[model samples]
Target: MERKKNISMAVIRRLPKYNRYLKELLRTDVDRISSKELGERIGFTASQIRQDLNCFGDFGQQGYGYNVKELLNEINGILGLAKEYKMIIIGAGNIGQAIANYTNFERLAFNLAGIFDVNPKLIGLKIRDVEVKDIDELAGFLKATPIDIGVICVSENSAQTVCDMMVSNGVKGIWNFAPVDLEVPKEIIVENVHLSESLLTLSCLMNDRTYS
Candidate 1:
């Protein structure tokens, strides 16, 4: 299973769409589904799906297809969704509050522990049952609580500083929403979500076809 674990990241990324299609099939009582049929639902070719799944052990039979529930569990396990992950948001701004209140993460085994903000007036606020605390308490709170991941939504000016603080607090992974790129130690994993860049790309696509 060395090779399986090696390609696990790519496989995990595709699990959501695969699980979505599998859920639809399960609703129809589809006990077994062929790679071709699964491909049609997600726009992937049969060969591609087979190759990706091949990294893991064979799940499909020679004549029949894969069991719906079995495949769902396998994919979920590979994606680390089989276990819940505790996370905290490091900003109480519009984007941060929206993310904290988002229901999507709940389905994927992620629990929003709390939200932090520098503003005193917003510190005691609640978003989707998760209380907002002062940013000053981040280090202490993290030390006391069980938080594996942190979502950074501070301003661009303070992005690096906030990221540094999070790293110092022993956060393993960070989802950065600031416009500026952050510099972190090699051990920390940082995923930047540049909303403006995505919008600009879409605008360029619509306004000018040259880039496209």
Candidate 2:
């Protein structure tokens, strides 16, 4: 049966978990895995896993299950991680530097093209071998170089301004780490990451014994 397209995001979000389980199975030299077995490894119901996979069309046999390597490639293509994404970071503060140094970016097909900062002191500095250029050079740099995404890690006060600059320079997607919400045009995709709220949720989960 064809799955409804309305719940695409929910299915999309589960791909990473499925990929992780598949990777483990591959490491163990498992050639094929039943939906029930895959779900057991990832804490999901077999039916749910089957339904999610059905959204991308059937890949499993009636009783044999799915091919581990084939499923991995399918999920990678679905998540759009099959190709590398060129990205740049705006702001050279701790968060930005951490992102520049993060090894997960390369694993997830995100390449840190460069870093930008408004502070004269931070400008010309190097983080993870990527030089921090002045914010004023954003447009010119973008014009000459190819970057699809931007990571905004500026302070709350300067967040919107920096976002505006990034948008003006033709950044399609933005990973915003600022506390304040930004007002951007409809064409730009902005993803907000609230560190404090995430910590608060983790603290609450840790303190609460009833959370399943």
Candidate 3:
């Protein structure tokens, strides 16, 4: 496996887009697809697709294009989708509950180990099939459970503290949905998903498209 540090974040980010289109192609029973055909469907140019994929490894033949299922599996492996990652969510709020209810995580090999919150009212509640646990139990829970990822959906004020706790307790990755930016050691892999920022960026692009 190639070291992730050698690849640009730009290439890494486009991986999910490729995976999504490949899955769609599978649903339509498309066995093979050329870069040109995939680009037409996904809005990326053929050259860009080829270049991005080449960074990881050569996946397609010059005349043969790519085997749809084979390419999907390769991309999935590159993205660590084949490994079952156990994750826990902190802050059983609206965003947290929504994440817990997401059915696609299992398909992607990310298992929800537990959900946590400080609220006494939510402690016994269940989101999807996972029971909500008290936030106070998080320290002990991490000791017992082999959690690969910690997801933060808490308010800005509490986000950092929760993240620090997760990291200190041996969590390898973090999927942070909190509004604030977290400061962590270089070793911790963190992906910050700022929903409001994405929506605002979309709104700006839409207005720009309309004006142009």
Candidate 4:
């Protein structure tokens, strides 16, 4: 089924959870599951699941429900995970190095093309076989090798400067971890991962919870 345009961001966000749960079903050798059952496992209402999937396309059958493997493949296609994405990391700090070390990045087809940092100590250090390079070399590296995604893990002060370098060098996607909103061309896509904000969200949820 073809993905429909203008799908709500809320629906788009739920797709990954569906994908993850479907993969788990595959691992368990579950061949098929009704929307009710799948929703039970995922903690969503069956009708909500049906509505979300319908936004993408017509899926499943009247009675037999969804085929686990086939649905997963379809969702993967929708999420643009079928191809490889060449990525570079800037900062090489704790957050940067942790991202570089994560095996799931490669598993998810995000290839770490290079890592860069300004500190002399981190330059030449290797993480997951990719040696850290001087930040000065970023422009040339981006020129030589086309990078699809640029990771910004530098401090807020340095984040915009690093983002500008990446954007000017033809990098289209930015995975920004630095705590600042970046200005980019309309065509450029930026996904921010603010650690502090996420932690605070958890705290807020905890505080808002009422005793049952």
Candidate 5:
């Protein structure tokens, strides 16, 4: 896929949502859908959907809107879902274990290569058949395994160290579930998933609605 220049974060973020909705539509046996119809289902305007998709290239026909299978394939390629990515979790706590157990990752081509933790108790335990290796082995493991993504599920204190270790060992993408912002080179892409922050945001919105 050609690198898209100047794509907004908002648009980049929506691509996955689009892929998800399209997948659901496929399961329903919906072959093709117009922009107006898709917008109604996904909460975006027909014009907005077209504009968002056009950031990469024109995908829909002038009258036909979009072919669901073709559009899904195109979006998959755009999101790098077409390639199988090897990823590992830096911590094997509840969140890390849950993520390792998720079956969706395999469907999306994100192979859980391994899981790691500093706790000796967790080491050698299997979460969904992926053994929790000692965190001390992470460095050596990366040297031999060609992992593309590193998931940081450690505490805030250990997040930076784990992120740095992953980057230094040639991991290009970091999915940080740890609550701290990690400092990495600009070339290394980081997606921070602040679960508490999202929950708090929801709380704030509900509070505002109560006051309104």
Candidate 6:
């Protein structure tokens, strides 16, 4: 299927939620579902669901709705879950170790290639089968391995340096757990998981009393 360009980030963001919901439906042996049913589950209106889906190619039929498994497969392809990605973590700290320990990423085709750290205590630690190596080895490792994603679990001061090294070594994707926003080239895709910011968002919501 041909993908259209200029798709808004809002729509792109919603695709993951749809992907998750569809996976749940598939696991429960759901065959098909209309937009209204899906919207109700997702708290979106039926028309809103249709509009968001229409950003991609035609998915549901006029009356048949969507074929659950097929829709999921298509969404998976859209989210690049169909391909295998080699990932390396720079910083074997709490966030990095937690990411390494998450087994689901491997199932989603995100294979952890290596882990690096500046601290001597953490340098030799093994999260799973991947041993944490010295941060000094990062440059050579990146040159040797064509990593698809570089995870930045280092501090704000070191995050940009790590990102630069990864970008220079053919790593276009970055999953950053650092608090600071990283500066990268236009081609580089950085997805940040700022823990403090997320918590602050929750705090704001609670104070506002607007959570539904």
- Give residue 33's error in model 2 in angstroms: 0.7
- 1-212, model 5: which lDDT tens digit per residue? 35569999999999999999999999999999999999999999999998898888878788887999999999999998878999999898899988998998998889999999999989999988899999989999999998999999999998999999999999999999999988999999999999999999999999999999
Model 3 residue pairs with clashes = none
Q: Which of the two, 2 or 4, has more TM-score?
A: 4
Better of 1 and 5 by lDDT: 5
lDDT accuracy of residue 30 in candidate 2: 97
Cα displacement (angstroms), candidate 5, residue 171, comes to 0.6
Better model by TM-score: candidate 2 vs candidate 6:
6
Query: What TM-score against the true fold does each predicted structure earn?
Result: 0.88, 0.89, 0.94, 0.97, 0.96, 0.96
User: Model 5 misses residue 165 by how many Å?
Assistant: 0.9
lDDT of 3 by residue, 1-212 (tens): 46335788888999999999999999999999999999999999999999898888778898889999999999999888877999999999899998898899988888999999999999999888789999999999999998999999999999999999999999989999999989999999999999999999999999999999
lDDT by residue (1-212, candidate 1, tens digit) is: 22355675666578778878888888999888888888988999999899988887777886787888998888777667778889999889899988987898988879998899998889899898888999888889878886778899999898888888778878889999999888989999888899999999898888887655
**What's the alpha carbon RMSD for model 6?**
1.6
Clashes, model 4: 0
Native-vs-model 4 lDDT?
0.94
Model 4, span 117-161: residue lDDT tens: 999999999998999999999989999999999999999999999
Worst 10 residues of 6 by lDDT: 203-212
User: Model 1: clashing residue pairs?
Assistant: none
Deviation from native of the Cα of residue 105 in model 1, angstroms: 1.8
Off by over 4 Å in 6: 210-212
TM-score of 4: 0.97
Give the distance in Å from residue 193's predicted Cα in candidate 6 to where it truly belongs.
1.4
State which candidate, 2 or 6, has the greater lDDT: 6
On the 0 to 100 scale, the lDDT of residue 118 in model 1 is: 95
Runs in model 4 lying further than 4 Å from the true structure: 210-212
Highest TM-score: give the candidate number. Answer: 4
- Better lDDT candidate (5, 6): 5
Give the alpha-carbon lDDT of every model: 0.85, 0.87, 0.92, 0.94, 0.93, 0.92
Q: How well does model 5 score by local distance difference test?
A: 0.93
